[model samples]
Target: MEGLSEKLASKLHKYSVLPFEDMYGTVSPLDAFVFTNYIFFLIIAFVATLVFFVVAANKTALVPKGIGNLAETGVEFIRNLCVDSMGKEGVKFVPFIGTLFFFLLFANILGLIPGTLPATGTIGVTAAWAVMVFLLYNYIGIKKHGFIGYFKSFVPSGVREMGPLGKWGMGSFIFILEVLGHFLRPLTLAMRLFANTFAGGMILGIFGIFVVLGVKEISAIGLLSSGLSLVMLVIMYAFKLFVGVIQAYIFTLLTTAYIGGALHADEH
Candidate 1:
């Protein structure tokens, strides 16, 4: 075990771990020059997104040219998506949901750039987002319906309307399942994003290793493998971009569903 560990550590030590390890630290403990490590990508993502919105909003074009046009398109898509999923009440959540979508899109897309780590690649980052949405929806539900009412809405009135069938056994049974499903949404959200990004990052690192070995070894098979790896890397990165966009959309879609459910549990 020790020998294998040493050999593996010797060969794959650097590539085996997460990226952007040494980037996060404070210059001083005063919180003035505090340097954040993993959050660096998040800050960059936020700045880039803010700049985009500012440019898009400040456009002077009458017919929505350039950034303004793109912004308008994005708004239309999100608005339609939210409304279709949540009805008119979704209008209130467009800004929030749109911001969520944009932030995630930027974060995921930024990771594709060489040497940059995505915040969403980490479970902590994804969980933070999931938890925020989960809490926000729950709070909205409780605020609108009160605590008991909000929880009570988990099980249908029909389940309890059948007298003994509802009250004797089925009501409690369905309520437990309903509670589990509601709470499990956040976990599923976090794991889906985190696992996809982390796996992609690790695969890229593995390809880097293969490419280096192939180039350094000076053999026909090694050269061929290296070339194949490079080609595969390009394809994988392109797919990663698609995955990022889809994941962002999925996350926002689920967020809207949760919010819509919380706001009108009876209708759900």
Candidate 2:
């Protein structure tokens, strides 16, 4: 028994692992947590969105009752967003934009749930989604206008309309600035989502710790601390829900705008 225990300890000593780890940490996004719970939350968001939409579709009421009304409202909202941002041409991209919005909306709200991790809090997850939008707009641009024309579209119409000397000089300067700005969009989008989600999670976590610590003692100070922490936690959760929805709308809005700009560079 002594020999076996020693061998087991020796073998396990070579690897460091978190208690929550489900597999080797190297392959997972959080790495230290192995297969982080955020992946499960992502699936939950996806399934919830799918099931909700499916049920809403099947239960159409003449007066548009319950989830059906919500479903209709959601579609109409997206339709208006697309039309406003990219004109009628944007209507065709609604499904894609809507999917992205709902996934994010659900993921953000999921974090407020007692034990679920927000997938958007993970940098890798946000980066992946941001890259998706980046590729999508680029593809749409290229498809709508040939590859060369798409690159040319990056130069604003004002530049092209300028006198030859101004076009070659001031236009080139403006074009370079515009290209650099566009290049940073993906990085900025990913960071914006990740930072906000992570910050919200951190606030909840810190207050949770205070609540735990305060509840351990029977003193008035302890009770006061616990009460404060609990109150703040409730408030923060509500605020985070609002933030999540706003972030989702912003992401979807930006996506449609990007696609619109790509498809109709001069006009948009």
Candidate 3:
């Protein structure tokens, strides 16, 4: 374990295997305790939501106040996106989609903090999120169209009616492919966000590596390398900040689209 740590240290300064016995670190025999980061993120998300509502509701300002303005801006931004994607009925999904966006945004941005780790970068976290989305979208579809109807929705009728694309042969294959594609949506969605955030964290770790080595060596070459590393670090951080916001938006938008599709599966 010690040797492995040393090997990892060479490549990444502040990046050790997680749960590294620091104050912010945790360990558990059951493997459940270390997953506390999920709990932490959930608490943070809940608190943030509460704070937003408290300020918005209490102030009740027509002219708008500090946090109220900010909160309203966020709300309006998301509401518009939801409406654009899911139509006027999208209003109902706004709260759920907006909350999802804010939670992910906070989680991603928190990683830029010196000691905080990104929970979203973890596979377990992303997988759980994806599963929830998959279930919700499917549930919405099934509710809208009974179970048998939902399954039947995947089979294209217009193709059979037209008798194009080599008639029945190509049509059946197209339906199967379309069904598979629908099933893979959640996997792709979750993995894309997870992979992007995880890569950003790794890039930040690389920047920290040079800084750490420079501090340890305390020499001319070390200083030069560290200086260059610092420049790269800032650029990488800026990019990550931009990407965090974009990823959160993409996730939320795609989620709305999925829900919308489910709601209207019987349509085109």
Candidate 4:
């Protein structure tokens, strides 16, 4: 352990760990968990959403206010999606879908904060969220279509009408494919967010390491480059913010698609 520490110390002239390593070490001060950084951001995201809505609701404006405008933007965005995807029936599920989108968007955006790890970077967090989305839509589908109807909807009856196999064969094939695809959606959704956030986090970590190493190793000349490295780190983080937003949007869009599928037995 001593030798390892020495080695890391020597390499500190050329490399550095991302910030807040000590805070998220082998055991966190908060709960002895291995991933304290993720917990921290999860709390922040939860609180941020709570605070935003609480304040937004506190003020009631006849025309429009700043917070009202912000709330309206989010509401309108989700409203448009819900209407387009699920039609009139979509209005009822707006709260569910809207909250899901905001929670994810807030969590993803939290990764851009200094000295903080993005919770979405962790596969566990992403997978849990993905699974929640999967279950909710499937529940919605089952509830609206009924068990027999929903199962039947999975098969492509239209194709059976045209072919020799008739309804039986085509329905079987489509049912199998659709079931597999449905099961796969959660995995894909989790992976997309996890991969993007992990990559962005890694990039930021690398730039931070460069800055620390340059400052330690190369005398005055290296010190100057350290400043440039810091700038690069900031730029990378800014770009990552955009990635977070896009991924969040994609996740919400896919979720809406899933819900819409559940709503329309014909589309299933």
Query: What lDDT score belongs to each candidate, Candidate 1 first?
Result: 0.79, 0.79, 0.75, 0.77
Better candidate number, 1 or 2, judged by TM-score: 1
Per residue, candidate 4 scores C-alpha lDDT tens digits across 170-226 of 677778898999999999999999899878877777677678777777588778778
Compared with the true structure, what per-residue lDDT tens digits does model 1 show for residues 48-113? Answer: 999998888898377778889999899889998889877888888889999999999999999888
What TM-score number comes out for model 1? 0.86
**TM-score ranking, best first:** 1, 2, 3, 4
Q: Whose TM-score is higher: candidate 1's or candidate 4's?
A: 1
Task: Determine which window of 10 residues in candidate 3 has minimal summed lDDT.
Answer: 11-20
Which residue runs of candidate 3 sit more than 4 Å off their true CA positions?
Answer: 1-35, 163-168
Please give the distance, in angstroms, between residue 119's alpha carbon in candidate 3 and its true position after superposition: 2.4
Report the C-alpha lDDT of model 3 over 1-268, residue by residue, as the tens digit: 1243563554343332345345345445457655454456546656766776677767668998787787788888889988887788888887888778888887788766866666677666677888799899999999989998887677666765665554467767877897789779888888988888878888887777766766567788878888988999999999999988898888888888888888888885
Per-residue error for 252 in candidate 3, Å, reads 0.4
lDDT of 3 at 22: 52
| Clashing pairs for predicted structure model 4, backbone only | none
Give the candidate number with the greatest TM-score. Answer: 1
Candidates 1 and 3 compared by lDDT, better number: 1
TM-scores vs. true structure, each candidate? 0.86, 0.83, 0.83, 0.81
Candidate 1 residue pairs that clash = 24-37
